[model samples]
Target: MAMIDLTRGLRSHPVRPPASGIARRRSFWERIHLDPWLLGMLLLLMLAGLVVLYSASGQHLQVPIAQGVRFGVALTVMLVLAQFTPATFQRWAFPAYLAGVLMLVAVELIGDMGMGAQRWLVIPGVIRFQPSELMKLAMPMMVASYLCRRELPPRVRDLAVCGLLIGLPVVLIAKQPDLGTSLLVATAGVFVVLLAGLTWRFIAILALLATAALPLLWMNLHNYQRQRVLTFLDPNSDPLGSGWNIIQSTTAIGSGGLLGKGWLQGTQSQLEFLPERHTDFIVAVLGEEFGLVGMLAFLMLYLVIVMRGIVMAGGAQNTFGRLLAGSIILTFFIYVFVNVGMVSGILPVVGVPLPLVSFGGTSSVTLMAGFGILMAIHTHRRLLPR
Candidate 1:
């Protein structure tokens, strides 16, 4: 039903006179101040996430309430970011990107280490920052700013410059041993470049090159990374080792069958077999407890958000807005996909988290920030000439 409404909204002719009149007539809460449809969808998903997180996190009451507070904070950030114009974003794109790169450097030089990775930097009494998360937002903005400067469908020279912009941060993040972030950062930049009209032939060539480089990439992967791929291929071979996560997560999902084991009744999570049940593997918890029906309903909500994003991208008034919005939205979908795929044993596990649903402070805030930019693009469409 959400998809159907979005489809109809897309099909309707967008005349500015009525749109502006409607905007003027809207209540303070009804304006693009917050996209009504998107906000409604987010509220539903976040509420559901809270419920799932409660169960996933050992059914603790404080867990969902604390996440609700984080959701409130993240929502406030989104609202503040939404107030900015696309022009403001475009104006600041390069600086934001540059700052991200510099911070990633800082993280490398003096970042705190945790869980065997140098991905965080705590400022004594201040925030514990993750620059890679910032790159997830900045990379697309950088590529959009770069491509928006040139003609539609960039030249080879243009592509090379964009490649440098993308590769630098990706390499930096990967050096921090964060393959998940590196992949997402690269994906965000590449999507901007692709949407900005890099030709299909060039994309195909890049794909071929990447495929050819697979063996080299595999050779360069960390020992655990290679073990993950091997475990993906044959999880049973090392049931007590690297494959434990995949085997357990898949069991939770598969056993849920259709309707699920019922909320809070999941043996895998309640009994403590699933790792990261509140973060990357939360979907398995959802699958195990709520079953297929619940999962599909949640997915429908997710697709609604994606659809609205695509619509916003299509409606953007400028090249930069379009490219940035589209890249952010697609990158969001990919993030969710990577998380789910890894947990379900279809892909090698990386550090990716399920977007809004995953229990992580950094990723949840970053994703909401991107959506804030999306709202800015959609709502700030110039009033049609009277």
Candidate 2:
């Protein structure tokens, strides 16, 4: 009987061949909690950014070096975060959200002011960063976690609660007068709610309400904020004053015709006519140096990244994973759109930096961490009963 049972077990589970070298290599990456395709694309994009940064910074080596170091730190944070499971993120969502909100409140009370905005919190000789950046991740996490346990196509009560959750931080950040980050945080939370099966009617009604509230919102804008809107409408109205940035940006991009003027050869950038060349307006540098062809190539790469993220979101094993991943990627798309639109003079300059391509520390780290969460959701999936 024992021999017969052993034979039956062997028949039920046949022996398999050993994994090939390629399979082993693939498994090694998965074991370390990394996604090869996503990582590969990100590295390629960052390399291109460094090349553009070198030219944009007047051929300065230090600029690219500093950005490279920040990239390293961001990548390390991503890998560390990727080691955790989706369940861990879900469990910590509420507490993280609460802590982030508290920090935003603290920023309101005693945050350091910089360049005309109270957006940073500094612990003397320790750390200085934006609480709004933290909410960029925390908002989606909290919303996704909240919605996963409830019924799909959420009820009015759930939607109201979610709206309240989203609105609190938005109001705080807007008070800090960082309109770009406030809108970004709001978009992050809203994406999660929308992904949880929001109805088309609710979306339309919300749009109507937002349209109606625009005038009231306009009334409360700061003087500079109002100037940005007016400038967007007609940059030529004040070409040498508040309109200088958009004018120069458009000049740089338009000058970079079919093949561009060549790397490090952009008159607008190299001659110092362009403003913020290394940060918010860096895309214009790429456009000037590499031409329309280069811009399209860069955008194609970005599109691939976005599509890959969407595929990961769809494949996620749980609702929380799907919602969080979808929101993060969609918010990232909004970042790219807003920055490019602002640079091209179609939208107001709200100080949004191009994702992964812009020169900045906090935003880079936040974005990489979000991708890390995505990798976690993808790699940690298991074959569980439905």
TM-score of structure candidate 2: 0.96
Error of 2 at 58 (Å): 1.5
How big is the RMSD of model 1?
5.6
TM-score, model 1 to reference: 0.92
- Candidate with top lDDT is 2
Model 1 agreement with the true structure over 1-386: per-residue lDDT tens digits: 33334444554554333446555655454354568788788888898898899999998898888888888888988999999899999888899999999999998999999999999989889889798999999899988998998987998898899989999999999999999899999999999988977667888999999999999998889999899889989999999988899999999998898999998999999999999999999999999998889889888888888998898789998899999999999998998789888988889899798877878788888989998999888888764432
lDDT of each: 0.88, 0.93
Give per-model TM-scores. 0.92, 0.96
By TM-score, the best candidate is 2
Q: What is candidate 2's lDDT per residue for 1-386, written digit by digit as tens?
A: 33334444565565664589988988899899888999999999999999999998999899999999999999999999999999999998999999999999999999999988899999999999998999999999999999999999899999999999999999999999999999999999999999999789989998999999999999989999999999999999999999999999999999999889999999999999999999999989999989999999988998999999999889899999999999999998899889999998889999999988888989999999999999999999975532
Model 1 residue 126 lDDT score = 81
Pull out the clashing pairs in model 1. Answer: 260-291
Q: Candidate 1 — worst ten consecutive residues by lDDT sum?
A: 1-10
